[model samples]
Target: MRVQPLIAVEDIERSRRWYQRLFDCVGVHGAGDYEQLMMPGDDTFFLQLHLWEVHGHPNLEPAFVRPGHGVLLWFEVEEFDEAVTRARDMDAWIVQEPHVNARANHLECWLHDPDGYTVVLASPFGDVE
Candidate 1:
């Protein structure tokens, strides 16, 4: 079985560029209003980004505009420091700076995406100083 998470974004292009700044990957499919991003070494799941309005339903209103209220799109990365640096360079909203989490056994840095989605960047304990 495979699991893919689809996120509704306000602007597809804006969100696409935002994600590209932080990740070194490409969209495997879709265009314009939707795209699926694929991480080279990680195949467990793919992230699908879509516009707030469903395609072919021009008159329909969006069901969810305010995303990530209680959701966290967490990513376990090997390049923890690089990730943090990129996030800062991209001017991403820093929810939490890099800090050790004893309970989680890792160091974490939380950030907000262009659409206000909470993204957690983390590395295993002792992975980086």
Candidate 2:
């Protein structure tokens, strides 16, 4: 049983670059305006970025152009600072600074992808100060 995330986007190329840099992911498969990314880790799931315009999925039309609602995706890391630094270096929009969640036992930072989906950069508790 594997769970994968299918994210609708306006531009596949741009989203590809962002995911590649942020998650160190590589293109596993692609066709036209859609691509599947395989990040370094267990191979149970892959990230799918699809161009909404090409697919003609009505729900994705306006939202892809101006995103709203949804939890989006969360990319967990073992090192919070390194992840945050890489995101910053790429000029990715940081929605929130790193903070500890004592209840959740993690340190996390939030950012919005090109399409405005929230991506969390998190590490287990005590991993970062």
Candidate 3:
């Protein structure tokens, strides 16, 4: 089974650009208000972004009032340090700094998207000291 995460954002364009820069992902499909983002070498979309206010719901502000209160968007990267540098350069909100995850046998860092969505960037633990 393939899992595709859909994120609701206040600004679609901003989120789209942020995701593209942060993950090195691409928007394979989308026109306005919505976009399906695919990771490198992946046929199916790994994530999707939609505007909070859809077209159908006229005069409706938003279907849900809360955004990313208890959710995490996890991702694994091959070039851990490079990815971290990119994130840092973008000035993305750092939820957690890079550290070794002994339990998971990997190194991980946490960040937040423009819309306050939690994202974890991890790489397999290697002898890099």
* TM-score for each candidate, following the candidate numbering: 0.84, 0.84, 0.85
**lDDT digits (tens) for residues 1-129 of candidate 3:** 998888778887899889899888898877678899988798899998878768664533564645787888988889899999999999999989999887777889999899888999999655244
How well does model 3 score by local distance difference test? 0.84
Ranking under lDDT, best-scoring first? 3, 1, 2
Residue 54 displacement in candidate 1 (angstroms): 1.4
Tens digits of per-residue lDDT for model 1 on 1-129? 766877888888788788878877666665888888888676643788888767655523565446766789988888888989999998899999999887777889999999889999999656644
Question: Model 1: runs farther than 4 Å from truth?
Answer: 41-45, 56-65, 125-129
In model 2, what lDDT does residue 127 have? 61
- Model 1: ten consecutive residues of lowest lDDT: 56-65
Q: Model 2 compared with the native: what TM-score?
A: 0.84
- lDDT at 1, model 1: 72
The residue-level lDDT of candidate 1 at 12 comes to 80
Leading candidate by TM-score: 3
Q: Could you give candidate 2's per-residue lDDT for residues 52-79 as a string of tens digits?
A: 8665776666553456365758777876
Q: What is the lDDT of residue 104 in candidate 2?
A: 74
